[model samples]
Target: MRRRHLIAGLALASSLTALSALAAEQGKPTPTTKEILAKSAPAEWRRPDPQNLLVMQLPTGRVVIELAQDFTPLHAANIRTLVRQHYFDGLAIIRVQDNFVTQWGDPNDDENGDKDKIRSLGKASKTLTPEFSRAIAAKQPWTPLPDGDVYAPEVGFSGGFPVGRDPASGQEWVAHCYGTVGVARDVAPDSGSGSSLYAVIGQARKLDHNLAVAGRVLEGMPLLSGLPRGPEPMGFYADPARRTRIESVRLAADMPAPERPAIEVLRTDSASFAALIDASRHGHNAFYPEPVGKVGLCSLSVPVRDAKPVH
Candidate 1:
């Protein structure tokens, strides 16, 4: 009887141990927020150079933009020149086209339109040669995406920027998406000077040909996007009084280092990036009903994070 009782007791203990192991295998361990962020984040995330930064102060708020140096060096330099002379301060956003762009600077855009322009181009040239698109070779390194693109033969990220390239023509230009800032020109391709510029605040207008797109507003899309559309044709405000005020436009380099906004952008090429893409497409959590298989080029949001702890 004693021997039988010992065997039964040992079996019961073994079953309990097996049950515990099964429970451990079945249970999904909850990942901490820090762990998720760390695992999802890449080590190669970079901060934009203050010198390349463009700070535009609107009546609503400040809009921070990063100029693409690799694509449009000449235009970027010209903009920097304008900023140094304080050309944009006190200027007004004269155009807010519905489902289009919100353009600022001299409302009198035509050569004959200027009566007494407050925003004068001190030393900067009124016109610049059309830098519509440039040649793209192996020399110009760009990480092409796996998915096929409708616009170009190759679509990818280059020099930490979203871009599209045509291998046949060996050319690439800035895509016309929301917040895309370009020089407004007439029928003449070379007519567009750095002075009369516009920012795209709506859908990506892929049809813009031979126009010089200088830079893009990186942070504050809403400031321009959310603006009330101009009542007149081409979204140009007929009345000057209704326009939004531009307090000032300054290069990040010009501002004191302490006053600059601290921001970090994630690098496209990294292991953590691969994981992030994977996680974003197919969610592992219970909240997600169905896993999304793919994400578009613009859909993949390059997150802008505040590096320093916010109070």
Candidate 2:
């Protein structure tokens, strides 16, 4: 029995060696991420719907976020109402937790602020049904990753958002990957009203299924992430002067066509995306002689491009 096992192992090793030799002879180097994106077809990119795009102007620059309405419709709608009413305008980025999140909202909403100065919610709800997760729809576009996850049964991309799923429960939620925007809430699950928001700047998978995800930052992540960390616990700015004031927050639909941002995001379900994933797992070049052979869900960022002008 021991001899038989040894023979089997030797045969497998020989086959692997032959395959390696064949691959070396082919001389086909793994394509870099740049090459993969450059070869992507036009159909593989999608323009975010104007209604779902939030354009936030800070003193530094503009930050564009794409709302995941399909995953969290209530939160998305509430955010939309708040934007239409200009609720976020003049609000401040009150927190910058190093390697965690950058938060922005009404500074008055914080513990030290004057209660009387708190901003009104306008027509938006003061509390909303917690959209932490939802029943996975059969028709939703889910491009699943091959690599496993520690937090959930499955991990994948749904409409360009990183997501985790549990097939047994038929539920899925937006993952707290970098640049993911989540609604801020109090102790109660129902307290999140989309009035306050935070963008993840580091690994925060622990937040999955705990907070209602509103959307993701399609551009201007540097504007959010490259800020000074606050002194207070949880990174709240101790001094009011430390907060970064929001210039304006406008929905793309509210802006004129010419004023709207012209950007496109690579479709998560495209062949190029699959190729990119495979490349991430197995690509090798002069710099990286050996493939990593594994990829985490958050390690990949979907590519974005400025839209080309039409003749």
Candidate 3:
């Protein structure tokens, strides 16, 4: 009788082990959320350059913008010039259209060739040639999204930046989405010079074509997202005082090294990154009721973490 009991206990233990194996095979983790992340994260996450960072002080809070040199090199360079000259030092957000963009710059420009007396462009040019789109085959490294895009023939991430491309034309442009910063211009699309600009804080306005898309707010999107709606069309506030003043826009590198933000971004090509996407699509955690089958590229929030000095 004792021998029989031992055999039954061994059978039970084997069954439990098999069940655990099955759970793991289903890509479900037995560990807590924190434990899973600790095990999944690799060491090669990137630390962004302080020189590339854009810091905007809003009345509400600070918005950190990461300039995308990969897509819009000229605009990024021009922006750096404006920043260095303190051109946007006291400029306020002149427009805020609900379900659209929040715009800032001198609104006094005479589009019809009238005399403009509000302000003068010190060093920044009043007009600039359009930097609308560029060739996709410029040997730019890109991560093609699995899901196809409606706007272009292809859509994916290149150089850690989002992009859309037309294979037939060999043309590509940065997609406009929330936190997307674009050059504001008059009726003429090519008139945008990167002086007057706006950032998309709402839905992806695909209708905006022939416009110059410059950079995006990688970190501080919430600062623009939560602003109150404007009364005017296209979100331009009628009153001047209502605009949000930009204290200064400076590259992180120009500022003292100690004052920069410490951040680390995950490498998209890493194995751990693949696992993260899988886990995110089909959430096996206790809170999930239905396991999702697919996800959009834009929906996936790129993971960013605060960096700390390794002792």
What TM-score quantifies how close candidate 3 is to the native fold?
0.80
Q: What is the lDDT of residue 7 in candidate 3?
A: 55
Cα displacement (Å) at residue 170, model 2: 0.9
For candidate 2, write residues 50-159 as lDDT tens digits. 99999999999999999999999999999999999999999999999999999999998877998899999989999999999999977978899888999999999989
- Runs off by more than 4 Å, candidate 1: 1-42, 110-114, 137-141, 279-292, 309-311
Candidate 3 ranges with C-alpha deviation above 4 Å: 1-43, 107-117, 207-209, 284-290
Candidate 1's residue-wise lDDT over 184-206, tens digit each? Answer: 77787766656667888766547
Output the lDDT of residue 147, model 1.
Answer: 66
Q: Cα lDDT of all candidates, in order?
A: 0.67, 0.87, 0.65
- Which segments of model 2 are wrong by more than 4 Å? 1-27
- Over 53-84, each residue of candidate 3 has an lDDT whose tens digit, in order, gives 77877767777777777667777777788878
Candidate 3 residue pairs in backbone clash: 50-253, 51-253, 93-244, 95-236, 95-237, 96-235, 97-235
TM-score for each candidate, following the candidate numbering: 0.79, 0.91, 0.80
Weakest lDDT window of 10 consecutive positions for candidate 2: 10-19
